[model samples]
Target: LDPFVDWLQKRKIPRGLGIVIIYILLFAFVSLAVILIIPPISKEVTQISENFPLYYEKIVNGFNAFKSNLESPENTEQVQQGLNSLGENLSATVSNVAGAIFSIFGGLFSVLLVLVLTFYFTINEEATRGFIYTFAPSNIHPYINSLHTRIQKKLGSWLRGQLILSLVIFALTFIGLTILGVPYALVLAFIAGILEIIPTIGPLIAAIPAAFFAFLQSPVMGVSVIILYIIIQELENHLIVPKIMSKSVGLNPLIVIISVLIGAKIGGVFGALFAVPVVTAISVFLRDIIEKKVEAETKLVQ
Candidate 1:
């Protein structure tokens, strides 16, 4: 069965088909997610139709403005303006509400999806190896296998260290918020976990909202958020980062930072989130090819 599936995928399906399939699956998942999570859009939906009266007034005013403009010559301009204003307000309201609901839990959904995909890839290690071998030259198999092993080692080491650091950060964040009596402590902690996906700027961005929301509730709570995030971020940079990323993929910290920012700029949060892994994978393959070239040159010289 495995051989048949592999053969079919390789022969019948284009090489790009795998990436396309992954994207389609991702879209389907996100679409279903949007549907399942749609109810939260208007808390009005769950708590019953609260916006009905407001919507009714808008409709009524819209019609009234249209009718008055059509019938009364002297009031034509004022009525036209009223109708236009109403239309603009309705459009703005819909946009804002849509933005708010979507922004509410944006990265959380993506983080979970990435984790799911990563876990699947990790578990099917042999299948991935076989798939890659199918595309490589027979004599190059040994070199590819060796390089893949090296990448796996890098992945395992990085993931273990990252998890430890993530837990430490999560603990500090949750404890600080709890101590300050911040509302939605659990939610904030969860947000921190999700934000930890994007390097550097993620925690900082998450912290801003925590501080802002806290400020809305109480000035003291807001101050606490600022102080807590400051300490956590500093600790992350000095202690956590060094411990987890000490002997990185040999990329400069500056390069990693730049890649993350560029990725974020390109694809928003998901881009930033996947940037490091993608960078690491590409680096490994490129180095592997370079090493093979070096060996070939040395043999020629000999």
Candidate 2:
């Protein structure tokens, strides 16, 4: 939004008008996406619900057969206990996700508050920056400004990169699922794209329902779906992450994974969503401090 406004400003448009135009454009894009996407997703969800009984039957049969094959009573009991625990955990997770979604939609006041704040900040970006700088020591103002700029740049890059990554994953998953004749391709792909925000466990979680649906169709199809997910995961890890995320965050994969886990542990979904950017900001500050310390040490030695 800022970039678009800046472009318009460079083209001789007033900042006020530029902001209005950007807002209109943003609204239109969101409206168009909802209009184009909602119907198919609704239909897919309906179909899934209608066919859920059959899928459930297949799952039950598979589980029963596996249990029967386990001859040792003790092992069989352990497996049953594990399955029960898994079911309970899955139920709780689903409930939490559903609640979160509902809460987001229900919180109109919160959403409007955010929009209002964004508008205020965007219009007063420079004033806001100067105001913040007033709190810091006058002598270190330059260092503080540099640090702020670096953090803002990294965060902006990260946002753009993440959006690109999600879109790419969505397209790729939709195509793969369509080719494999999977049900609810759009919804599943959307899920995969959205979950791509979570670091290590996201893709794995996205694959579960996809593979489960495929397995309901056939064992071979299930295996194929799993393979497809693995291939996509590998591509994302090796090619996509390197190309898109490497320059944006400049954090190691291990750091990202750990940050996400910590964030999730602390604040659940929203924490995980923001973990990387928060870490990036902290890293920038730390790097600046380290550089300043090294310079001082060098000066003392001289």
Highest lDDT: which candidate? 2
Summarize candidate 2's per-residue lDDT along 136-180 as a digit string, tens digits: 778887887777778877777777887889889999999999999
Candidate 2 error regions (>4 Å): 63-100, 107-112, 251-278
Clash count in backbone of candidate 1: 0
Tell me the TM-score of each prediction against the true structure.
0.51, 0.81
Candidate 1 C-alpha error for residue 270, in Å: 9.3
Per-residue lDDT of model 1, residues 1-302, tens digit only: 12223444676764345444655686798799567534443343322234434544655665675676586675776766776786577556645755655685687777778866765664476788889999989998897788777776665556556666666776788788889987656556656866775567779877975785577566687887999999999988888788777864445455668888888899887887787767777778987789889999999999
Q: Rate the local accuracy (lDDT) of all candidates.
A: 0.68, 0.81
CA lDDT for candidate 2: 0.81
C-alpha RMSD by candidate, in order: 13.0, 3.6
Instruction: Tell me, by TM-score, which candidate is best.
Output: 2
Model 2 poorest 10 in a row by lDDT: 90-99
